[model samples]
Target: MKRRRVPALLLDAAAIVAALLDAWVHVDPDDRAAAACALLAAISLTLRRRLPLLTYVLALPAAFVTDAVFATLAALYTLSSLTRRRSLLVVCAAAFVTGDTASWSWPGPEFADLTDSGNLITVTYSLATAAAPVFLGQLVQARRELTVRIAEISKARESERQLLSDSAQAQERARLAREMHDVISHQVSLIAVRAGALQIGNRDPETKEAAATIRRLGVQTLDELRHMVGVLRASGSDPVELTPQPSLTDLPRLVDSSGIEVELHTDLPADLPAAVQRAVYRTVQEALTNVRKHAPGATATIGVHHTGGTLRTTVTNTARTRPALVLPGAHYGLIGLRQRAELLGGTLSAAATPDGGFSLRLELPVQDPG
Candidate 1:
């Protein structure tokens, strides 16, 4: 599978071959005995990845009786790499010592000094040689595990960065939506009301000139709205057009264009935060727009009062004698205006007044003098 596993496979194949050849040529006289030992060792090597302890058990007998050194080394490597049990390793070491002792004691060709206890030196040499394969396998296994852990950590960090990017984009989208709703809805409502008044008063030339000016203003507002929409759609690729934003100062112009005489009363402070001013402006604009659409030819009055570190605005309009044609209502503009107010820690309410009219009220906190 992996390139690293190829070397382990080659090593296992070589070990099996060496054990079979040694048994056949030097240790076992019978052909069947050597073949059986070779087959068992090969099978144990293959199963070592899944059952390391079992491989050690199968290789111990051949290692002790016939000096199958390759079989012993392969089993030891598999056991050390695949198993985490320390008790099992101690048991395997005991089995190896006992098997090698039994094989050395057996009467055979006395090539070395047997009486002088020099055989123990051979046994120690064989044990150390067998340990080499086990150490190599353990090192390889540890490196592979460390590589895998580092890769997982990198992936997790990448996922967190992507999530933060998505959250920032979503926040920007919501801000753009709120701005578009506040700007376009107020301007369009004023245009509609002024156009209706100009159509009704056809006898006066001055009224016609004023209506023409209102029409030009409406067109300019629409163009600005389109540019804002384009910038929002393109994201950072297009720069936002820095047109003048309507603050609380523009409230008088909004009332003038509504085609209804609005009696204004005020007690607002000299200066306020930019966000508070914009929020108050939009709240009044939305309320007056509702008044013009729902109640035609009615006298509307706006009241602004600053008290207890809060600015409060109220817009009330009387019902007309003749019922006006109600405009097609999408209802999202009011909800968005309310959300804008709440975002600035303010409150807004709209309801039918007791005096046969509609009333809209908004209250926003004002910063105290530094």
Candidate 2:
């Protein structure tokens, strides 16, 4: 029977009917003490499950003295079903059962005694009657425990499946990043190179401005592409081998091809790691391109300093003499530059100066720590 408020009441009704029947059929109406004892056991069965062993304690004497099988049987079943300790259930049930059937009036007491001859059938019959509820109750208890264990296993498996799915998505993202870098890096670089060449060939006020705008847009696009590639890599996607990135050696060509006036100063270490040189070149490229976009016809200064284990680079541009169209860049150039600097254990900063000019700075460690 289910343990619920309504079901408990219903169980009480069923027990009452069974108890009344057994009491009326087994106990003589003239026997007041026996009828009272049966009534007491029936009342105790009402809360047999609610009180645990307490109801069993009260029911035992009435069960052994009278023949109210319903109350005693229900009490025994509830105890066996609710109690967790196997040894306690076994001991209690055995004691209750032994006393319950000891005073039989059939064939009778002596012939059906525990060690009496031809008494095995009746003794076994009594044992079976007492054991039925306990057996069934234990069976239901085992089924409930099994159901709980199965549910736990199902939850664990589902969690494991979700983890695997997430891992797969991360790997896919990384692969996409790598492939993007491979496919777009060369084409974007070519656009920047062509724009820079055009700026050098045309020096007219409007032509120079247009050429610079083209170069600036190309570089900004490259910065966005790099940022996207970084995102893909972060997500765990692997890309194919890519073209070599620009480094310190490429800085002179980068500046000379820009077609804008620029002054350079350097004390950079002769032997610098490729990563540090790449970060320095990229930072300079981003700063110079930003100047071209925001302040066309501006003269810029590039500085590289080597001090012990750290390297510093700075790019500063004079106030604008020509204004270029302010193209909509998703603020990706600075983000790309920052990512590059951080990847090399370095920092990059860019800000407007008091003189209405712009300045960009990068600092990096000589050795790779990653």
Residue-wise lDDT of candidate 2 within 1-370, one digit each (tens)?
3466787788778977787788888887788878887777777876776895887777776666676667777787888888788887777777666666576455554233667654666567667876887888898888889899999999999989988997898888778876777777778788889879888987787787767767886787788788777766665345543445677877887887666789988876557887777788878888887887888879999999887667889999988988688697888988988998888888888889888899998988784233
TM-scores for every candidate against the unseen true structure: 0.51, 0.54
**Which candidate number would show the highest TM-score if scored against the true structure?**
2
The residue-by-residue lDDT of candidate 1 on 1-370, one tens digit each, is 6898999788767776776776666565665664566557656777777877788778776665566556766787778877666567666765666565553444652343446567868767656665566667678678878899989999998988987886787578658856786766576767857765785677687677667657766766776776666556565454555456677788887777767779988877767888887877777778777776778778888998888888888888887656778689898877987898899898889888787898888888886655
Regions of candidate 2 where Cα sits further than 4 Å from its true position: 1-13, 104-112, 115-118, 203-214, 223-370
Candidate 1 regions with alpha-carbon error over 4 angstroms: 1-203, 206-210, 237-243
Best by lDDT: 2
lDDT, candidate 2, equals 0.78
Give all candidates' CA lDDT scores: 0.73, 0.78
The TM-score of predicted model 2 comes to 0.54
> Each candidate's root-mean-square deviation in Å?
14.7, 13.3
